[model samples]
Target chain A: MAEDCILETSGLVKEFRGFVAVNDVNLKVRRGHIHALIGPNGAGKTTCFNLLTKFLEPTRGQIRFNGIDITREAPQKIARRGIVRSFQISAVFPHLTVLENVRIALQRKLGTSFHFWKSDRGLNQLNDRAMELLTAVDLAGYADMVTVEMPYGRKRALEIATTLALDPELMLLDEPTQGMGHEDVHRVMELIKQVSANRTILMVEHNMKVVAGISDTLTVLARGSVLAEGPYAEVAANPLVIEAYMGTEASGLASIPANDDRPPGPLPGEGDDHGSLRSNSGGAG
Target chain B: MSRRVTIAYLLGLALLLAAPMFIYPILVMKVLCFALFACAFNLLLGYTGLLSFGHAVFLGGAAYVTGHALKVWELPTLVGLLAGTVAAAALGWVIGSLAIRRQGIYFAMVTLALAQMVYFLFLQAPFTGGEDGLQGVPRGTLFGLDLSVDINLYYLVLAIFAGSFWLIQRTIHSPFGQILKAIRENEPRAISLGYDVAKYKLLAFVLSAGLAGLAGATKTVVFKFATLTDAHWHTSGEVVLMTLLGGMGTVFGPVVGATVIVTLQNELADKVGSLVTVIMGAIFVICVLAFRRGIVGESLALYRRMIGQKAG
Candidate 1:
């Protein structure tokens, strides 16, 4: 069980000035599992993602990737070590063609990223693989389209395709479906599941339905610390997790079912927008 | 390359080859020098998204180096030019290492401040001839062809411009160029994709400085002098104006921008005198207000729109 952990963070901590954004998080992600880190706003989920990817260095902790200490590694080195992250906002190169965006990732492996004098005609060989990745995300039809001109949800799909181009062992997705219609969310969720085969995904997701639908394990964070960790059903039913998510006033954990696609009751601090969610899902269906 | 673009390039080349017969060769050589300078500047400002406020340091610094080598050192023309380019590249490495540590306006400020320091150093340096400028730089022979003749020098400058232009074009389309555009579009995303963003930016800075240095070195050989005007902050500002007026990121934008600005400066310098500055300023204002994409970018956008409408 100990050896099964592909990424393990022991006593991870991050501080901005005097304020501790992520406080002492000890996380262990098993190999080849779709792990979801779900939390409300300001739960330091994004900060944790930043820490893992080395965008923000940990104030105190040891990040071990396959038992090697990576806490001090640079962000690009971490990426080169096969841990790639997607931005909260769709991260495609806006002016580049969709195909070109994916090709940029594929080009990294060609060992000629510094050969400025060579013609890019050599990169044409990468087009087939770029198209394959694009097709995987159902973006083959829009290969020639400038990414800025792409539909919002499709841009997210392209982000996934670009991330896939690196063939990362651990893919960190930050709000993969943050701003999406129900149909798009459902599609992205399906796409995430499809791409998660034989690879580990550590995603920071806010949408409960998407989290519940695909994730193999759940890590609930609140106030920058782990509140609960287990299977979805178990974590969703944990009293501390429920209290943290809904405040003390909410009862009956069954209201937020593990398998239900319909919008759940409004969690604490989020305004009552359940009606809009239901209507969006209904209209999309 | 597209057939249309290739045809345009060829026709432009032919026009330049025949230009010396009709126009003053010296004036054409001036245009070519500036055109190359602007193109090199665009590689950083346009493709890499780095706005260098101190690029005049490279241009002026190289001019002084070339002038000294030719006049004082009595070095061959090619060797002098090489020395100038290498010096600029070394300076670029030093400045770029520091400037890339900051980003955006901070990056610009760092480059600007460093350039000012170099400018002051050049002012006090004994070899530069100070206020008098480095005078009477020899053209010398290049591969047994005496470059003292205007036609011979013009052809050499043309060859240098064409070769450097081809190199820039190749870089823009290379694998490295793809990454550069990615960095320009979204830097953090590029970093997260496992790129050393700072390293790429520095390399780009060095390459741009080297090419700009080449242009300045060539300019010194053509005019037979290197002056404080070459390194002035105004020259830096002028290159920016040329890039912006021609088009920031387009392949041919800087060339067109340089020609227009240099031609206006020359034609108006004798007639309107210093008012040429005011006219250039007015043109800049109009360019920014009306065509923010500059001439080439706007034309391309318009052409694309027309083609899209027809296809649709």
Candidate 2:
């Protein structure tokens, strides 16, 4: 019950048919911190994120944003409540330009108006703000470009700026650095860090190194349940994690050193717990 | 706006305004009515990415309603117009609710099925006069003056066309219109964004249908008849063809498309009465393949790109 906890999910559960995708998950995201959720895979990280954002309703649970119950609110309503996300896939309007895409998001944030009789270009505040977000993401140079023509990576970056246009108090990044080369990953990581300076950030990432490099606190999920949760150092050295990691990837992966420079240990449980849950389901289902 | 576009719009407006003097006023009125019809249809197909084969329901339904009001009840022109618009909106509400149940091509089938039902209703309804329809209806004065003359009727039609066009333009630029676009682009995402996507879509459909009724209302008086042709599935097809030819989402695209189809029908009606159908089909194909954005959409896209490059 931290005074400044920005987000909290209590007993969150999402079940499909007879199987549970996310099971009785309890988590907290503090203010001005980059909280990373990581697991090997199928750790229910995505399902948890979906429930938190109200993109998917939980079968049973409570999602509170700054002490407000938002468990069953619509995604846009939740987004308007100051939580916004960038999807794993680029979700921009292909027909509109990069600037227009950002502008649409800005327009949504502004109150609805019946008077569109006048020119739409006079909203200098929105344009200036969108331009700022584009610059922050290092995409100011491509503002005028039609979204469809932009390269894949730039499109992804623009998606982040679009989400930013909603003026989120808590930003949800679903694999922000995914599908990138090392250099691009580094640049995005820098952008995320800069953004996290003001707003709270919660991310579900597969990259263990990036997770460790950014997260202030971490939660590890396995089979829709918490396997471990805490600061990066303590969880990395846990023996249960090593055992879990080794049994995954069909290759029984290499050992993560107990004292390795493994980028600060993204969240406590990291990928080990996620690997175990999905693999076990393969036999059960 | 680019100088060419500004000049072209002005020139087109001038030509349309002077149409009654050069062309038979009745022919000019026909073009304007159909143009408005095409623009109304575009609200759904182009702006909302909905292909409604049921739009003839609005056009024809309005005609029948206006026909009854003007001929049977002898109501004034305003009353007839209101009757048509209200009937269209009612039909739009029911059909939009049902048609929106499916998406993509399936939605098209649903609307087409619904429209066929409406066509049958019009065929059997007592007010429709079956095959004969309502004939020799008066154009009526604005309030008390007789607009029975060709010049007065032409001006009336032109004013309706201009008002409907301006209203539609305003609708597209509104917040609600933006939500519809969001639905068109990605329904699931729009749903996730918290807007009741279906409600927004339904409203657009109803409004489009109602405005289309206004066009149909004026058309009945312009031709001095209300007939089965107004409700024909061919009418639906023709409207769709015009929208596709003009580009789905552009403001003036439907107007230009309507004018082209109307002019084509006039000139080509002599050599081959039905050959205009073939020509319209060909134009639709050419527009779809070569200029998928339509004349206005492509031009706007180009303008946007050019400005984007300049900004860049």
Candidate 3:
């Protein structure tokens, strides 16, 4: 491990049954840096994130965060260690006010145990802190509005603010700009930069422009293995990267072609459709 | 919850507390007990979005414990209440841990199956007094103050009901409750945002179970009897009916539902007796299909609409 490395994984392997989802992944994320993982579909970017976050255990290999092994820690335990994740789909609490959503996350980080008699100390401080995060994301004005009522771009911003509540040392972002309009993508990219100023970040992104715009180093994966690893410019020009990006749909479909062309399929009463639909949707790739 | 909603709730609670003067104290006691039970159940179903059809296990389990403590052990009333609550809390942890592995419909069925197991256990267990139940248990006193008089018992029941109601309102207002709501709305998103959803679900379940136990414990002492019907699946359906009719997520919704349903049962007890189950099932369907948000929820919405109109 290098002196500046904040998160590192060595020989990471994750398998389902006999099939490999993430095969022998080795990577390192430097402190106070924006590192992006860009790979084609079925490249196992999400599986790697899941394994590292302890949502799923690896078949083999170890992950170290801030020089401590976190390969086997529980998901919440890993979160308590100051690592947090952001999803492509917004993770903000929709029914709660935007401020309340972030404040709840902040309260959780402050160990807000379930109690019927406690005072509102953590709650007040958390509310203030959530406002600060929302301020950073330019969402402060919408603080009291229900998150679901907010525009989509603002909702995405709320997710980032909530993730920031964990006080993360290493932030794992899974497709931060998915399904965004150009303005939202640009805003999210700007927010990501502001967030990374105090943390180390590892992201799996499909949008090349966003990756190139902010990433200090970029790691590319193809078919569950590292294809290239370097700065965005180097990784962008790599022949292997281009091949993998273009080759993705062919190999991805071969493994589960039935799902790609199959109709919405029969209802549950049809029997065989249930088993097939379950298998198809149950994570083959 | 909105500010106007809170104001409306306080108004409703005031009316409910005053209702015993008009209605029979026994009727008020029954409603309060059932209301507490439903409110506790709502902590899980409403906030965490996990439905437990086996809550009778907690309700009935506490009834048995409190009944046994009062009858066999001759314990103080408060001691019986605490014993019942602790027993139910422990049971909730065990059942919740296993049931939480599955989600949605599976979770419901798992709870239902587990409740049936508890039902049979009560049916066979000696301490539960089998079919006859533990009869003639004493309400005794609040620290030996002789709560035997109906008026005294009414106040005691009122205090317990109010305390439970306040505790639930406070719990939902807490940050932990906010997190539970988040998990209910979007569990995978909550997990990605670093919450251990299973832990949240279990915590909500345990809290709901404990309060429900409190309700059951008080009920046993109130009526001075614990019967097989207390632990029956009908009771489980009864609580669900109350929650649905009251408002699944709103604080006062379950209380209102409980009061109305209990009153309906009291009215029908002499007329159609055995048909209570059929009527409750029908209400459940009607509530789910036609009036999902419930009476209090609907009332709150109307309040909001009025407020909006005033602001405009």
Candidate 4:
């Protein structure tokens, strides 16, 4: 069972000054599974992602990847160890062409990323592979286009393509479909599903459809701790998870599919609770 | 390179070769030295997105080292230049290691503070000759060519400048350069892609510093002296102004910027005296206000727009 888990965290805690952002999270992501980490606005999903990637040091805890402790490793070292993460915001190099963005990721494998004396013409060798990755994300036509001029949804797709170029054993995606139209969201979900073959993906997602449609396993967090962990269907029906998502009086667990596209409306006596959730997410941004 | 750009470069080189015939060779040499220095500064500022406020440390520090080697150690000109370049690169490594820990304005402050320390060390150091400056340094022979002659020395400076310029161009377009652009565009993204961002930044700082040192050493050979003015904060500020005036990121922008500023100072010194400072300041203000993309950057943008319209 231990060998089956690709990434595991035990007693992982993160605090900002005196305030605890993540408190004693114990997580296990099984190998080759599409694991989704989902919660309400202030549930510390982003903070957990930061700790897993070592962008923020945990106040107390241990993180293991393939049975080796990686709690103290640098972000780049973790990435080199096959944990590549995408950003909540689109992370493409704005001035570079779409092809160049993917090529940069592939260039690391050539071991010439530090060779300043050599002509970049050698990097032309990477163009075919870069184009292949772009083609995977349906960005082959936009290869020559500067990334900043790309539409918002296309930029997210580019980010995914760039991430895929790394060919990581485990890919962590933060809010991959945060802001998108229905068409783009569906396209990206399909892209994610297509790319998940033979690779493990751990994603922090807000869209319930994206979470419910693709995730093989789900972990629900509330107030920096795991409230429920199971299949999406099972976690959705957990009474405590329902209360954490709505209030105690809420009986709308079955309507989760319908309410997934929009924020759940303010239930009676839950007005202040909903308002605070909105404000917390806004402030985090 | 584009056909248009290659042609422009060839034409520019021809003009430079013919320049000494009409303009004073020493003045043109001075411009070349400063132009190279500005270009080195631009590598860190424009391409890598590091605004080093203490670049004059490398420039002036190398000048002093080259001058000392030639006058006191009696080393060959090439050796003296190499020694100076290596010293400045070492300094850059130290400074960059510390400065890259911070970002934006804080990074600038760290470089500035360290440069001030080096300035004071040079000011009081016995080898630098203090306020008297390192004077009467010989232009030692290179390949048995007597560089004492201005024309011989001018050609040497031009060769050095052209080589360094080519190196910078190659670096800006190399695999390393692509990483640098990626780092500049999005540092965190670069890191998440498994790049040790600090290492790249430090390497860039060292390269930029070494090139600046080469420029300084060449200037010392041309003028036969090294002065306190080279290491001063004002000189550091001047390089920033030159880079901004010409175009911060574009190739050839700093060269044009350095030429204009150096020529203006040379031309105005006799007529305006200290008011040249005020006039330069005014030009800087106007540049920041109206020509933020700078002379070369703006022209390139306009050219692209015209080409785009034609294609459309």
TM-scores across all candidates? 0.94, 0.83, 0.88, 0.95
Clashes of each: 0, 7, 0, 0
Q: For model 1, how does the per-residue alpha-carbon lDDT over A80-179 read when each residue is reduced to its tens digit? A: 9999999898898999999999998988899899889888889999999999999999999999999999889999999999999999999999989877
| Model 3 ranges with Cα > 4 A deviation | A1-3, A119-122, A247-285, B1-17, B143-145, B188-199, B309-312
lDDT of 4 by residue, B1-312 (tens): 456766877888899999999999999999999999999999999999999999999999999999999999999999998888888889889988999999999999999999999999999999999998899999989899999999999899999998899899889999999999999999999999999999999999999999999999899999999998999999999999999999999989999999999999999999999999999999999999998999999999999999999999
Off by over 4 Å in 2: A3-5, A15-20, A41-43, A113-118, A223-225, A238-285, B1-4, B97-102, B143-145, B174-182, B186-196, B266-312
**Native contacts present in each candidate (fraction):** 0.86, 0.27, 0.41, 0.94
TM-score of chain A of each: 0.89, 0.84, 0.83, 0.89
| CA displacement after TM-score superposition, residue B7 of candidate 4 (Å) | 2.5
In model 4, state the lDDT of residue A5.
94
TM-score of chain B of 4: 0.98
Q: Second chain TM-score per prediction?
A: 0.98, 0.92, 0.94, 0.98
Question: What shift in Å separates residue B231 of candidate 2 from its native position after superposition?
Answer: 3.2
Number of the candidate with higher lDDT, 2 or 3: 3
Model 1 per-residue lDDT tens digits across residues B1-312: 456766887888999999999999999999999999999999999999999999998999999999999998999999999999999999999999999999999999999999999999999999888999998889999999999999999999999898898888888888888889999999988998889998899899999999999999999999999998899899999999999999999999999999999999998999998899899999999999999999998999999999999999
Give me the candidate number with maximum DockQ.
4
Clashing pairs in 1: none
In model 2 chain A, the worst 10-residue window by lDDT is A250-259
Runs of candidate 4 exceeding 4 Å displacement: A1-3, A247-253, A256-285
Write candidate 3's Cα lDDT for A214-245 as tens digits.
Answer: 78888888778988898755665567665554
Q: Which consecutive 10 residues in model 1 chain B have the weakest lDDT in total?
A: B1-10
On lDDT, the candidate that comes out on top is 4
